[model samples]
Target: MSRRSRPRGAATAAAERRASSRALPQLELGRPTSRYGRWRAATLVLVYVLMGIHIAHWRIRGRTLAPLELNEVMYTLELGVVTAGFLFMATVCIATLLFGRFFCGWACHILALEDLCAWLLKKIRVRPKPVRSRLLLLVPPLAMFYMFLWPQVLRMLEGRPLPTLHLRSDEQGWASFQTTDFWRNLPGPGIAILTFAICGFAIVYVLGSRSFCTYVCPYGSVFRGLDRLSPGRIIAVGDCTACGACTAVCPSHVVVHEELQRYGTVVNPACLKDLECVAACPTGVVRYGVGRPPLLRGWAAWKPIRRPFDFTWGEEVWLALVTLGVLLAFRGLYDAAPFLMTLGLGVIVAYLGLCVLRTAYQRDVRIGPGWLRRAGRVTRFGVAAYAFAAAFVVFWGHSGYIRYHEFAGHRAAAEAVALAERALRAPGGETGGEPHDPGAVPGLPDPTSPTASSGDPMDEPNIVNRSASRAISHLEQCARWGLLRPPRLSDTLRRLYTLRAEARVALSDLRGAIADLERVLRLDPGAAGVHYNLGVLCATSGRDEDAVRHYSHAAALNPTDPDVFNNLGFVHLRRRAWGDAERSLRRALELQPSHALAHFNLARVLAASGRPADAARHLAAAEQLDPRLAQPADPAATP
Candidate 1:
């Protein structure tokens, strides 16, 4: 007989086995226990909450935190970028790293609702052991058949337009409706409800336990790769005792026990830390630990219960069916709020109907384990409730385009005006242009005032400052007339400027008009029409600060005219200066207020300073008054 080779460690192994049998050893899987059962619940709620906040930021809903397109900037967070941007791509990457498809588990609101749908559906699908039998097994395949045949079933979107859904939300045909901009401008409460009902159903049945992860999802492969470095992993130990509890609970269908022979101990990427294996390990061998191989993490090492995945098949079938319905039916309904609401109501009623069917089935059949059946029924029922919740949450994709959804900004005329304004203000000031009479241009309306009170008529300040006056005048003119689709401001300026003179003389109390005319003058002094308008406005309004700027601008821009110089003198005379008043009145007589009456006023100023003889001479000559200057001699030097 061949001598049997005995391993050197046999004696020690036997002794250790005997010692192990004497007392149950304390084993630990993970240092901490994180139950996965509640994770799905928490995750489902978070997505809906996030959706709700997004909807509140719309303009049509009667709120506006900012409007960047007005050419009127309130402020900017950055020199060229808006704030509140989303990091969707980044979140996808993070989800890839943990548990392989956790976004489906954690962030996907649809999936959360689906979990409930599965439970409810199970109640309806309830019966004996048909899940693996021909009766129950056909559901998964039959579902695939229906989904593939009618690819348009995924119509349950939060806010697709009615036209897109092939329903007439408005007068337009479906194609025409799509051509319109319903997607970008609208939101309603109905879409939210629809999303909840359909997505809820998908999570309840079909794929069963990690259904989205196993079939339909392409992202699963990506996640599978990333979870290779998951801090928690599943492993098989020599002490496993050949028990099979881990396989029963696994939602993802990863063979947890097979790792013993394949990988030195056992660690496949399939483990999701669901903790079923730890409880099922009768000898407490299968465990989770950090670093090195053969370490598992979850609740198993410290407790009991065969850890089978809460996996079921209601999920995939449901997703396939609901996604199909939403994609098709939910399309064009978004345009009208009422239509969307009606469609949402229809979906809610349908969900209830399905719920009734499922409940009857569950009560009749004793097919699955108590927990699974309950989960199936409960999950499916959640579909309707979730729809209502989501309807409230999405508000019809209201926040989808927020934070930087601006279209390409290339409107030519607006650009030109903005560019010109930007160029002149950076210190050097003037953008020189050859002279041209705008009044001669065709199609250009003769400028007029919106109100009687317009431009300044007071102040004889340095109007002769040629360069500054010319530059400012040109810009002002451009601002009033250059921008296409000009806002109401230009016309209003013209109105005030047109009536400036009367505004000054009558104490018209049109002080605001004079102020506006002054701003226009600052922007464009060479604008004779505006200057003419301003001088008239100020002389009447008694807005002296403004009156001076406009009068001087008009006087300088059209200096060849004696009427302007004469007007200038009268304004100075009104301020009660003696010699200066005389000089201005003299220039007016020389340039010509021709007997425009400024000289008559000037004599008063000179006389106030005690030039009695000069005052008497002018007073006697002015008795031949133009008569038109009678009613409002502007009593005293209020200027």
Candidate 2:
């Protein structure tokens, strides 16, 4: 209901009637007789029913239309995928331009969730008081900018060319309008639950109905802007009585009667065109109709409609700063927190912070008719509330510490891996067209030799070693912190193990690297890339049998990967298994006819089987494919 709407108590209604219509005859305010809420609720239910059917179709058919989410605009901006979400958002924007945000009022699942929470609270005799601040309301627009505009701005500044708009099939992943993996863009189960709890239930109970749309939803901000230009609006169709019933039933807090009185229409952008105001107007004066859009209203007819806010200007500033800080603090905490969930956390925490301030400083403070402080003295309730707020603040501080280490560890590991890749690269592109098999770092620092003292820092083995050491230390520390409070996703811990394994490889600690990789496989046995990497490491360490086993597993998981077959063939050749080696090499050649390493290995298999003519033919093919294959010191020479 409208923020200034009086409660349904007789005394409150009498006061509102006397104050709002002192000149006219007094009229009793009555509850809305309209069934718009029922219709809207049914429409929202149908939305969910369709969503369920869509998911079920994907499960049974193995493909479906991509999820229609406004946030998919991010992929459109960054990757140029003209997704179904992008088209849906555009259609909704156009609809808002004509219908004044009817979708938000009648179709959004989040709105349904908020209304359900509000209903449940009312059933329990709780009416959550809405907290309004000038600064906090800017959050929606700011978030809209961050989500939809910032990526392109960053790309322009970085001088990167915009990606070509293109479509991808399900096999290619992240298709524009269709997908095989339906949940690829969705959050994990834990994150989904947290999102519903925080954004749906917690925000509604703490900040009142539709507060997320007002203070946090980026998509709502876009619609709000479009709503200003829509001709469709609540307008006065007849005259006279202003008993304020229209204002008393507006769920968006739009102060409808005041708008109709001031501008002869509800010009407030917050209006969702729910028609509650129209249904509640006792005089039948208000109705929905097309008129001149708010922008077209001449200044002479335009009047400033002042509405009261819950916070003073200084408190609004404090609210904005605290909310921003808490938002950044909780965002992606434990690698599981989603953005909307974190935004709700920020708003709720900011409200609690304000309550603490008021209880501590203000005289005669009450929360929902229960006095927190009386006559400049604290009550027991006040003390308990203060303690709760303090504890929550401490919890947030600890979360910030964990998030810091997670980001730091990832940053360090990325740098170490990049440096190690540079260190391992051949100096002159000597491998030609041959695939650089996984886990092969050719120019690694020799375990027996002293560190290189080259003048160029890039040529120094000591620098690479030190970077790898630093990465290992950070990653280990990150894992230690994670153990103290385990993340909701096992993938986070799995990634830590995989990254640490790469660092160990850079340091030439083959045994330590194998242990870390094995731990990763335990966490995710179907990790085909991990299996391939383990195979290369085993082959490098002369465990041909183990190498063959891992390579075979990797091949089974990803049969289309030609490099897996080629590397498996090399392992077989090392074990002198001529028939198995020839079969594997031929399979690799069939997958990729230009695979130089497979041809080179087949040459060895043929020679060992006493086929000199075939050996010479395969050797000539390998040399023609990669001129560097003719060189003596090439490591693939004898494998």
Candidate 3:
């Protein structure tokens, strides 16, 4: 998979994709789109242009995209903080979901670093590196650690949005756009740039291929599924003639020929469709097409297509992995045999599996709907899904950090949103056969509905009961994944916490949930959702005083969360503090009048606290608002 192990036949097709890659007796590069680097270059300019807008807002405007930010957009799936640079973040996600990783291929800062590293690697001769066994062991853990921590860091973070980076703002390259005192220091940026350059060079050549995209770059991970789900993709048109050109040219080390035979598209997330494979096809069979190809002929040439990525993938970050492997090997030589053997087996299996899968899956003919040539409504649906995911990523990824950083009136801004969105939030019970204004943005067709907001969201084919149930199930699974861990003291502790807290409220042992969450907070106190969870836990425990404290913190963290206010009010009601209870409940009602509980509780508190006229008014109001709420709070009769 290291691009070198590729059968040495594809060099020619790649010559045309990158003008510079074609340069040589040295190293042949990109394919047909080489000329398009003009626009690609322009894209980088445009990204910086957006970055300029972000800087301008931060400095002259003294504001950034709050509403457009991700967490503000989608807290349902707390992916991460979305950049406060709403326009930039929005563009990155929407455009990417729509157009592929044109941003990364053309303008990503990390991609630039990779390019520099590749250039340096070419300047000298070195063997490609191997992946380290130990890193794999740690990655799953690290990934899990970050997942739990992110929501909390999101809760604790001051603000500015994240999954964002410091804009490298020089005339020639990315520079620091943040004007804050923290970014004034040059060391971190300097080290980062240096690290990128070294890794890029090592990865492209000696350290393995496409290392940056596979291992180091965060943006690449974001765009992988986007590219896979996209309707159009670059593909090998016909027989590859067994040329190695495409493989050699791919920075991500993708097999151009294999893509032509399999899914019939370069659905591989790493594929940017630079089209080196088509250019490398000496047999003149390779061509880019819409769907999977019709004629799947050519196993001789099919070997290239059949080669699975399981092999060279670690090479995507092979160099760092190799370094880590060496370290691990050295350490393992003296340590546990089971651990070392497991690690070794994993590495061996990955590489060997890639080789075997490619050979095993190599097909002589293409598969799938032959008529999928045109982009249809499903494609539009795909586009919408991409946009939704992208928008969420951009917003959630960075929003919390903005809150954590605490800019001028940020806390106030959040509270305002919580009061607005939550107080008016539908509370899941809608009666009038679904509201008309479907909340679809004007001009953009709702992938599910051609009409504007008139259609019932639930009635829509995509959002119908079955699909919604499936979606809810999927989300629940994801949330539950937060608790998985090999048994340990931590696991036991988590179980204990859930036994005491989450179980009592939701009738489930949620101590694991708390343990998992607390672990996250330990890593990133500035995260957005941590305080919110703590508040919920406190409320269920009848610790109103503590609940209020956590609720306020949660409110401070994400003003957009409506449930926070509802709970805050509930805590106040539990304390029997009528005035504060009324205020909290009223605020919750304003945000979401459909909330039967808020109305019921407000009415109950009013009646109990010596106000006949007011109590009668509330009693009438609660029944009208929710007839179910007219009943008393008997455990059996409770909502």
lDDT at position 449, candidate 3: 28
- Ordered by TM-score, highest first, the candidates read 2, 3, 1
Task: Please report how far candidate 2 places residue 177 from its true position, in Å.
Answer: 2.1
User: Candidate 2: how large is its RMSD?
Assistant: 8.4
Query: What TM-scores do the predictions have?
Result: 0.30, 0.72, 0.35
lDDT of 2 by residue, 197-313 (tens): 888888888788889989999999999889878998889987737677776666676667767877788887888877877777778889999877788887643433534466666
Top of the candidates by TM-score: 2
| Residues 1-639, model 3: lDDT tens digits | 334454332233223334433432223433234445445556656766875676567666553333222222222224333323334556777776665666667767546655555545445543244222324424333433343446657655866343432333234232223323322212244444444444444344422555545544434555564554454557555544544555556666665545555544455566765555555556756555555322233333223332222222343355335434432432222111122222222333233333222332222111111111122123343344346546744543343222222222223333333332322212222311111111111111222322222334433322222222333232233234322222232333332222222222222223433554565455456655566666655454445586688677777787765556666766776677778877877887787766656666666667667655665666567668756546544312211
What does candidate 1's lDDT look like per residue over 1-639, in tens digits?
A: 111332324334445545633433322323222355565566567767755554444424543322212111111111222211112433554754543434545665545664565545545663121111112223333333342322333323434322221222123421211123223323334555654443344333433444433332333344444565454355555556544445534444445554533452335543555555556566767775533322243332212122222212343244334433432333332222222223223333333333333433342212133221242354443445456546743532332221011111112223333433332222211111111111111111112323222334332111111222333343344344332223333443343333332223222334544464556665455676566555544544454455556657776787765545555555565555556656756776766534536546655665676666876566555544444333234223233
Best by lDDT: 2
C-alpha RMSD of candidate 1? 22.7
Off by over 4 Å in 3: 1-33, 37-42, 45-99, 123-145, 148-206, 278-289, 292-639
Deviation (Å) of 366 in candidate 1:
15
Could you give me the TM-score of model 2 versus the true structure? Answer: 0.72
Best of the two (1, 2) by TM-score: 2
Worst 10 residues of 3 by lDDT: 364-373
Query: For all candidates, what are the clash counts?
Result: 115, 0, 99
